[model samples]
Target: MKRFVVCKTCGARVSGLLDSPVALDFITKAEQELLSGGEYGNGDNGNVYISTSDKHHLSYHQDQNRLIGCCGPSPYGLPNLVCICKSEIGREVTDCCTAHYVMLYKERIAIREDNTGLLEKVVSLPVAEDLKSQYEILINFGEIEIVLNALKM
Candidate 1:
């Protein structure tokens, strides 16, 4: 079953759930380096990244003369990925290296079941008091560590 990645604040569909093998490989290597005492980002505040190649649902900003990637660092050196509502959702991290992925912060996005199953079955499920919370349940797509670490940050 497919899942949808949405903005937790406004319920805007950011993108569909998809796996990026290149990101997995990059994250694995980063984790190994961290385990070995190698430093990444600020001391003890290593930036956690979620890689995504999909940017069609997102908008980018320009700082000075350069166009900022969906999740790239802003002119202020902060993650610049913001929803239409101006909420900082994530950052484009592909510029950090040759990798083609965006580093999305988990806390900024909500994962919800696509509900593409039978309509009758979906409707029969108990209604959630807080629909947002219900959709916040993390679903593992072979990248649990990325979501976990993003939460830690």
Candidate 2:
């Protein structure tokens, strides 16, 4: 199975995952937007919901993808990603600026624009019971270094 993660804040070169998720939380909107075309400053201005895959990406790092905008970017922007992970997890992800990531109460679904430029639900992630796990999963820099070395890149 393929796994996805944002770059680590620690000294790790890149972020990878285990068969079990190491991250207790999802990636942040600020990071997600950066992954999308929402660059920090104008090389890029604000509100360019356009998708660009040609942006420079680090080895083993795919900054952007099409047909699947992950659980992050949307035509509505990351600030609007409030309440994503919309699985009733009750983990309150306030990063969406309370814009409701899952509008109409559907988060994991993909909202695509048609030829007429109307956004609609093309597809969505299946609703599943949000697994509540015990114990903490921490990714220390030293552990990350080991994992980075294990990767092909």
For lDDT, the strongest prediction is 1
lDDT of 2 by residue, 1-153 (tens): 322222222111111211221211123443332222221111122111111231111221122331123443343322222122222111111133221121111222211212211111111113321210000011221243333243322
Give the TM-score (vs. native) of candidate 2: 0.16
Ten residues in sequence with the least summed lDDT for candidate 2: 129-138
Model 2, position 123, has a per-residue lDDT of: 11
Q: lDDT of candidate 2 vs native?
A: 0.21
Give the best candidate by TM-score. 1
> Model 1 TM-score?
0.47
Worst 10 residues of 1 by lDDT: 34-43
Model 1: colliding residue pairs = 71-91, 71-92, 72-92
lDDT of 1 by residue, 49-119 (tens): 33343442566544422334444332234555677666777665443333434445566776555444322
Residue 31 lDDT in candidate 1: 16
Model 2 pairs in collision:
82-96, 109-124
